[model samples]
Target: MHRPTPRPLAIAIVAGLLQLPAQAALYAVDPGPYPPAPASGFPAWYQDSHGRTLDLCLTKAVSSRVAGAPGAPAYMCTLLPTPGVFDDTQPIVFPTNFPDEAFWFTADAAIVDAARGINLSFGTAIEAAFAAEEPKAGDQVSFARVRIRVDVPVAGTYTVTHPYGVEVFDVPAGGRRAINMTRDIGIAGAGDFSGALKGDVGPFLRSVNGPYTEGNERFIGDPNLDEPVTGSPFNTNFVRIEGPNGIDLRTTVFSVSGKLSEVNRPTPLIPQRSTYSRHTENGNLRAQQDVFVMAPPAPATVTLSSQTPALALGEANGTGSWYAQSVLNPALPLTLQVTADNSLAIATSTPTTTPMPLTDLVVISRAEYSLGSGQLTLVASSSDETSPPALTARTGNGTLIGNLSGNGAVKALTTGLSPIPPATVQVSSSNGGSDSEPVVLVP
Candidate 1:
């Protein structure tokens, strides 16, 4: 189990207030297929079993470059202060940037090798494009997964703390135990796609034929009117992970998918003619998962706040589509306060008076210049991949050099510097993070 350095009085007070029970600690581990190439040296990183890179605190957009089978031009986005993933010091919020509907998974567990004893693996994937099917087709969907392998292991308790809540399992030591958890949110009947909001699936948003309003008033219409729901602790919207275990072939898996988007497809009854219909009719298209590792000493004290002006606690943009939760205990719900465009502050803790600046999230990971070609290659990453940071360069004397550009997280500046390189190269992002490194002449 891994633990971070403790805070003074605040932590002591929190422990006394929460009065949590005594339990063994667990930390997250990267079970990797590993990256074929480097992310240019970033922390909390790995190339997952599925060939997708899992770099903590950063957003990764997985989509298709061709007709289907999503791959290529992979996005290595910016880093953000994601509390639970790398640091569980804050509550996990959904639809991070209004309409983005970006849900994530983080873990607090250790990485163990199978040959030594336990074999573990983890990763995530999203659908390539929208398609219909009898057997196979693309529909908007995404998921996170973990695979554990061990033999004739110890007999003890296995606990998984995820975004949803904490679940406990008792193992007898020699038998096979398989854990499966699933959740699906979206339209009436779109069939088998794992996507919730309209923006995720298509250009259209959810709407009804006539005027209607529910007394709840949180949303204009029943957002989850006719959607399949599963999982404990939450009926909808959550992600986290936890583990510390023995052998006995223990395998855990979970998936989240939704078909909220209405698209053109052949009516189920009539196969030939194409008709506009919801995807729920297809059924069981995708899945989801996230992680959380519990360690000794003390838990990270976190505060829940809205990134934007939201309507209410557990609701965003006039709909009950977003929420926040307690990573430690599922029974104890986290609180939120909405004061006219203000953030969602936890009732138990003091709210943050200032928002986190972009400089804190965006960063220049590495930069270098080639003496032969006079080309400078810069690599950067951000937690907010949705809003990629634009990059620029400057010289020691404060003169503008030239802009850098490249696909994904890498940027390149080929023009402007010739005979002599700038004494000092200062690279910066629109998001505020910058790095100044000496332009070492390299052959």
Candidate 2:
């Protein structure tokens, strides 16, 4: 059964005070600055382990209030608001020689090709569809590492608002203050994206808004922005830096993806092969995301039900803002209704009444046909193969040649045609994943 969205609790707030979420702890050491050093470049870029690229560069800040203010040198970056498109908060600009690496948002520390490393240095704009991998057997977990250091023109208390939560720090005049928030989201422990209010600022994750509709459901190019753990109007990702006087710079919300896991790592206590799937099924009261325990040999016939404050899985994964899966998919506001034989742990997210397509949720690696045997094979894979996408094949003329409800990864169907038809083969998924390759004659 679907769990209902939690209603906002009644609370009072004292104006002009920084509010941290209830029970949220401070990061011991923040993830430091991006670029990490000096560099020469205009528009720069960094690609994560999964090949997801974040482009950063210098652009002139624009603000009507700062008339004749020589628009401070600000940052123009890509990743948030959507991948490929450049957006900036036009924060007060940096000094002319401000090291490119020391800019506002730098891309750093990522898991690539199953190995961990950092992709430093900005590059030219590279356009690519946004994609993220679910944490399963053999795949390394990924996450966003962030730290904020603000050079105060005139120091006071600066309130920092981001996708996860809010942070207020004090900096002396002309002193640089670094908010060590590197531990916001991690495999172990909780992030600061959700929870109760300590002051006026708490969960800063966006809810519902014009153009930013669907809250945090998968946006067209960004499938990882679906924050179903919190449910309706899924919140997108962003960071707002506000300081004394009238200093306010807010980034355009963007989308990214990551997951939690326990392989060689001792913490987070996740099963080795745990994974998840996000979908919008009929009758769902809110956004729907479900988890699974990929227990080797075959996919189990396990069921999931939404539960308030989650269940044992939540306790097992530790606590805080980090969800069971990607902040995009999330793992709060829901849990698994496990069977007695179910030893694997799982969690859930808020349900979505609306459905959206998640890119690469099902990826088709190869589709080919053997002319000699007239045998056609479609090889595809999803994060969760237990509930794989429906596979369909057709001719160029739209002739339905083969179809199968995907069971595992490879689906094969022999045309059995005595004389193989001279046409193309196309494969598609019920979840909007697809591939088309010309009919290549192969022995």
Candidate 3:
């Protein structure tokens, strides 16, 4: 029986602010002065115990409205999810260069050989931690050793901190995702992109936007920037993820940005909210940027049904099954939930419905596929009572396995990625609710 979903009245992971939505299209903010971290090839940070470390040293004060004033000339950075996730607010903040080495990080335990040739793939399931706006250098910020599951091969990208770090884990035969869960990233700070930002900030961001976007960090590579999450308009823009050894990654970023203005469709998100800024007093940190934190007023009787905030990729091994649309009732204003895990909730959003009344609340839940550096034979299936359900499958951003039929499935293969085993393979459904199951090839 279809159970009518009720309004969820729970605090998000941060317990300070509510997330927007996990999968909402994020705006192109600053990747905090980083040209995409290496997308593929060897990882930038890794560890022996299935975990990786990222050491960001704060040398100078990160800008806060120039003179700590609103609308001041400052290049500010806020932690946001890559791959268009915006709901996460209280991201995890690790001391990359903390005074000691005892810090620990319970990292997302999934890795993939995105390319067959030891190509690393980072997991976007991890959210970002908006650290205090401050300097970058001298002050050591260490991503505590993130532990990967010892059994699965940690071979892809994983979110160590605000940036992406490559990790590798041991995988037994038939093992796909093996990352340790209790290690930390320990490194010193080193980067000179600040020198590049001297003359023009736009060029610097543009140059690095590809790496950021490809790394699933925030960058304005989205061609579908104009559309809402569910609307088809989100597909209009082209934000491609390129690896470090990505042959076309650099070029593609340039091509898209060159014509971004001409596209004439992409616009800034939260137009009313200027880039965020903060004014810190002795004890209070006031927001210099006037942020209207209220959600866009919804009209309908929208409510959330259920959510799976946290998921272990290993549990998704093989063809597992989960659905997010069971809470959707055709009558009440549609309020559906897929994940309730706080860690993965980095990209969750509050719900608001104004115009659309609930006729059929359905979501193409958790539909995604990633190919490592090898022969990836992908298969996707769906089951629902809907007659002759519409299904679609396309690959880009994250591999989009479109709508599925009523009890339908789709499959495909590719060697286009780097030659490594997949850390994890994600699957999702579009219409009549949704489901995602990892295709653990090795396991």
Candidate 4:
């Protein structure tokens, strides 16, 4: 399983001794995927797999008020790490004492309020919830889902530590518990909610009705209420809380589905090296070539063949394709020819052709010259039907022996007169090529 790296918890502490303003004004309400409307900022709520709405707040001001409400409060939600900021950018370290037990908690509205206050009554509820939902033997408990409300007032942007999973903590015995709520929870993986807010309204209807639909017989009124809901999913994070006493901490894993624009961008095309080769007519010699290309644009083709019948040729292969050929005669020298066309369309401003020559040669005859003869005679045969490749002769130390004719005949040579070893003769043809052979010179 590929888990995303966890980021440092952006802990927003709620200190009892710290003083706050007597009153604070409401900034805005983020309704999230329900009651469709364009997101004014990062979402303050998200729906779990169970279809329950989890309200997220950046500060304790709103969350504490809701958590302390007399009746059923909105689901408390916390921010998770943003995929853009935390994913692949930071290391996630799990606590050494992290618990292994998993338990589910379903607190009544009153208990939920008490939990928000981190009180004894809330701990009692947690114990009960754990006992009631303990997993049976042979069953696996991956996470715990507790119904709690959390909110923060100082909101600009903050990451949710866990998106699809809940974080668990063991509440220690009474003391100034330095509980860093931020650092306590572990991060699940990434989740996307892009399609969560998109309503089932057809595209045609959306275009005709604008942001909302007119009241119809099938429905009471416009569900959208003329609110713009089309936008990208707010990539954020979430957190869950449990235990100070005997509460066993464990996570209840859930899967979040949808595409994230931050992670799903267009993939650009890349160019690969192209190749080709010559083969024999009897299918003995085989040369294989391959190339890689992306689609939507037409795939490119590579051409493989020798200029002359000295070497057999094979048909061109499609992009990422290969072919085989055999040499007609192994004893003679041959050149494999390769040409790539349109392979550079994706990697260059303008498409260009690429050609390469691969040589296979075996020496057949050596050239002989007399010292101070100023002349040399050489003869050789090759696989090239063109015959009589261009020739050059030189000493062991690279001193020019003299220029030679296409038939391996040279005149006006001078270096061979020295006590140097036999000069080296090299043969090449327009289509067929050969390896260099030693030339013997006599005084």
- Candidate 4 has its poorest 10 consecutive residues by lDDT at 121-130
* Model 2 error, position 386 (Å): 46
User: Candidate 3's C-alpha lDDT?
Assistant: 0.23
All candidates in order of TM-score, best leading: 2, 1, 4, 3
TM-score for each candidate, following the candidate numbering = 0.22, 0.23, 0.21, 0.21
- Prediction RMSDs, each to the true structure: 26.6, 23.4, 24.5, 25.2
User: Residue-wise lDDT of candidate 1 within 165-234, one digit each (tens)?
Assistant: 3445454553322332222223222232222221111111112221122221111112213222221212
Better of 1 and 3 by lDDT: 1
Regions of candidate 2 where Cα sits further than 4 Å from its true position: 1-144, 175-181, 184-236, 253-443
Error (Å) of candidate 2 at residue 421 is 86
Off by over 4 Å in 1: 1-352, 359-366, 370-387, 416-419
Model with the higher TM-score, candidate 1 or 2 = 2
Q: Roughly what TM-score does model 2 have, to 2 decimal places?
A: 0.23
- The Cα local distance difference test for each model comes to 0.29, 0.32, 0.23, 0.27
TM-score of 3: 0.21
Worst 10 residues of 1 by lDDT: 267-276
RMSD from true fold, candidate 2: 23.4
